[model samples]
Target: MLLSDARSIGRVALPLYLSMVAVSLGALVNTAALGRYGTEALAAFAVTTAVYFPATAAVAGAVRGVMPFVAAKADDPPELLRVVRNGTWLAVFVGVPAALAVAGAGVIARAGGVPAATVAQLGPFPLLMAAAMLVGGFGSTATSCLVGLGRSKVVMRAGLAGAASTAVLSPLLVWKLGLNGAGIALCTANLVSCLITVSGLRGRLPGRLGRTIHFGQIRELAKVGIPMAGTVLVKFAVLGVLTVAAARVSTTAVAAHNIATGLAGLTFTAAVAIGQAVVPLVSTRTEGVRRAVIAGLTITVATLAAICAVIVLGGAERLFTDDPEVRAAVAGLLALLVVVVLADGLQAVLGFGLAGLKRTTPSFVIFSGCYGVLAVIAVPAAQHGLTGLWAALAAANLAVAVGQGLAFRRASNL
Candidate 1:
């Protein structure tokens, strides 16, 4: 029964999984490119992205509130257009401030005690990321809308295009312009993604799309999106703190931390894709939701384990960098990184399952409380280097994973 149900869910999840993994692989390549550029360049990339990713995620999550509504209204073209319009407006309302904030995050990097030299080399990376944020908001909304309408393959195709751009651009640009070139490469890649997804979305809508802002629908999108955004924001905010803490340790520490977590993100996205694909399926069958979540957890664990095993056996850590110190530092933290990735993957599926049920409030409450604890302990944990810091992070994820599992069971009676 579970195997049958897993195959059913995989139909929707496979495309999402492929798309996200492709994007992450592009990022991994970007990381490798910047790593070769030198430790200072790598540190600059870490500092800026620490700020960029979370802020953009919050905006994207906020905009995605329209997806379920879009799905519900899919057969009704008029209402679907309205949802799309409001979702677009929400994208702008949230995207603009985020861009401005990211543009100024060099200050935050300084305040966070990143070395003056690393902070000095930031250049136009922040500005480029700011532009990416604007495009990202729309890309996220368009992708979500397409997924809601069962056009996930369109999203996948768009992602592959972006990934291809990143692979080609990161090396060429970074080699010429330093890490700032990385910024341009990343921005262009996101632009490519945005254009494609928006184009796909355009084909799906039949009538003339108006540029009118509907406050009522914006409020509805916010009602669901904000709490969901809050959940994503707090989680990223905590990681941002860790980035700062790693910076305090050494450039090598921060860079190694980034590589480890970046790889973990590759695995975490598998669960993220499953959780997303399961959302529309969630309302239809309670038992099916349970089966999907279980299948998702199993897949997430196996994927991470396999990736980690390959990294260990193949001595492929060299693929990320030539810095022996950085490689050694990451090597010591591998077990903890595995724990953190597993816990995060498990909780993500459960938390997203609750979100699918339109029960996002508890997730916000649970993450806030648990991660709040991690925030408190971050400084002390960093005193022990990456090992201690990751241990604390792993503990927090486990607590949140347990909390989310209980919540999912209570909400769905699964």
Candidate 2:
């Protein structure tokens, strides 16, 4: 029965998995090109990308919470639109301030002690990244509505379109125009992607003045989003410390680290997609089927991780970059990272499993400790060097997987 159900789960998960893989691979392509450029460019992206991640990830998660909830009400467009409309307002309320804050931070960092060249690249990049994220936020909510209605294929198509644009644009921008151009390309690519994704939804785009703001849902999104945002913020803290640590080591070290991280991220995306796809199904399934849902998800994540491990272990140098020393370092990191990646997959599965059960708050609490506290501690302590960074990451991933797995088991018991 579990095997049969797993097949069903795989059928739904495959497209989403492929989409994530494509996106991750595109990032790898971007990273490889950037790694070739030299340390300053790499460090600049590392800091900026870390800064951008939380904003995008939070908005994405908030929209994600809507999928299963909205799915159940597929027959009710008015209700769905109302909910989506609420989400859009939240995007503006939250996103605008976030854009300004990041851009402002870049300005302040320039004033503080950062090099002039780094400062020049930093200021405009955050605004572009933020604008991309804000537009992407709306797209995320719209995509959730479509997914809830069983239109995941539409989501897949839109994502592929976006990834295609990014894949083509990133290198061209970097090669021709330098760092600012790269940032501009990223923003443009994401904006195009969001537009394509949102167009897949059934509802009309609310005009800039369609409905007065719904203070209630705005508050609720903030209530949910703030904690979710906290999770992302904490992640940024860890990345920030790590980036600073890498910079102190040397710009080249930071660049190498970025390539290694990007490669691992590419492999990890398969697991993330499976975990995400698991949520709506698990949410809809009965208690009797919940275990089966989880079982399918775990299997999907494990299988994907194994495949990535084989590929990376086999071709770490070629896949990551051409420099022998950088390759050696990255391969060692990837070797350790495969274990971490496996654990991360499990963690994602368990975290989203909890989310599927309408148990986000507990997942949030667990993640806060796992990701926010323990994971945060590991990175800096890894100041032993690149190897140390891997060790730190491994410990962080293992802890989160075990902790979240225990939480899921307990939650399932109730």
Please identify model 1 stretches exceeding 4 Å from their true place.
28-47, 106-125, 173-181, 243-258, 284-288, 311-318, 321-332, 382-388
> Which candidate has the top score in lDDT?
1
Worst 10 residues of 1 by lDDT: 278-287
Tens-digit lDDT track of model 1 for 75-177:
8899989889888888889899989989987999889788889889998789999999899889999998887776888889989999999999999999999
**Per-residue lDDT of model 2, residues 1-414, tens digit only:** 666656655665676777666666666667666767657777677667655666677667766666555554555656667666776677776667666665565665666677778766564666766677677777777776665565667667767877777778878887876666667766776677677767766444333325867788667545544555665566656666666666666666777777766666666676666666666666676664466556656675668667776767577557546777776666667667677678777877777776666566666676677656544565465567877766777777788778777877777778
Model 2, position 119, has a per-residue lDDT of: 61
Evaluate model 2: give its TM-score.
0.82
TM-scores for candidates 1 onward, in order: 0.85, 0.82
- The positional error of residue 385 in candidate 2, measured at the CA in angstroms, is 5.6
Residue 49's lDDT within candidate 1 is 87
Check candidate 1 and list the clashing pairs: none
Candidate 1 local Cα displacement, residue 295, angstroms: 3.9
